[model samples]
Target: MSKALQEDSKARVKVLGSLLHTADISNPMKPWDICAYLADRCLEEFFAQGDQEKELGIPVQMLNDREKVNRCTSQVGFIEFVITPLAEQMVIIFPTLSFLTRNLSLNVELWAELWKNSFDPPTEDYEKLMARVNKVVSRCRAAGPWEEEAPMRQSSAQSLLSGSESVVTEH
Candidate 1:
């Protein structure tokens, strides 16, 4: 893979790991077990906040095991969900947790900013919300099997966003 593609893949894994860590804490369950749970919760959260279509696209049904979660988004949209287990496992085996953690932190901060700016009441208090999320991430760190040192490539956000519309519409 080209250097840029390789770097992007590494970054995607790190971001995905961070997301799983958040889900694990929010639900306090094994990663596999949390898949449906996170999906449900995200649906509720996104819908309740008036961002269902904009943020989550649509309510896709749960996929059978071995089926990949579908995703799509346009230039004017946002999509959020978990990475696949295969991808998740790959990142967990990567050998640079510190780098991933740093990148995760920056991304989380950016997310918080977006959240703050998106709401009239500023929905969540960024610092407090992040602190709570961080607590879960810390637990994920202690749980071990950290995915570090893996080299991989990631699709562009634009590309990743493209396929989600079908998934969302199917629900």
Candidate 2:
């Protein structure tokens, strides 16, 4: 058990415990592919719940509504808004657990890329989507604290843009 998880604060015990138990550090060795699979399964459960809710004449949870949900973007929001912040705060309390935040950060980046690609796709292609996912998965670095941290790459609009792509658009 992580030292952070073991210590429970009275004022924030409920939330703190929830975040600690669900954070990446709780299952550090979990494979990325398995994580994606589990997320898909969880979404199915949510969709089922929404269906049941509709049958019962109740309002469905916003994201749980199968018709409106975008798997990639919803996941990105959850990880970015909830999980990453929790993991990052935990890292501050336990510097040794910094790797947890690094893993989470990369996960958010992956989801963002997926969202950017499929945000408004008029047509879906399973083979192409899987190829993109696999390519992104291939480039993911393992969350190993022992590995040397790579230097951050610097980029600006001038360096990144060459074609008709504009960083900002006029309304």
Query: Per-residue lDDT for 1-171 in model 2, tens only?
Result: 455546756635765675557554332223334445566677788989999999999999996788888776666556645565456556555567655655554444444444454344434543454454443333232222423432321122122232222211210
In candidate 1, stretches whose alpha carbon ends up further than 4 angstroms from where it belongs are 1-92, 120-128, 136-171
lDDT of 1 by residue, 1-171 (tens): 236546798776766776576445432122212322344455455444544333566643443211232211110012112322222333355534334333332233333333343332234455565564464345344434445432221222222234321213321
Specify the highest-TM-score model's number.
2
- For model 2, which pairs clash? none
- Estimate every model's Cα lDDT from 0 to 1: 0.36, 0.51
Question: Could you tell me every candidate's TM-score relative to the true structure?
Answer: 0.28, 0.56
lDDT score for residue 23 of model 1 = 48
Clashes of each: 18, 0
RMSD of 1: 15.1
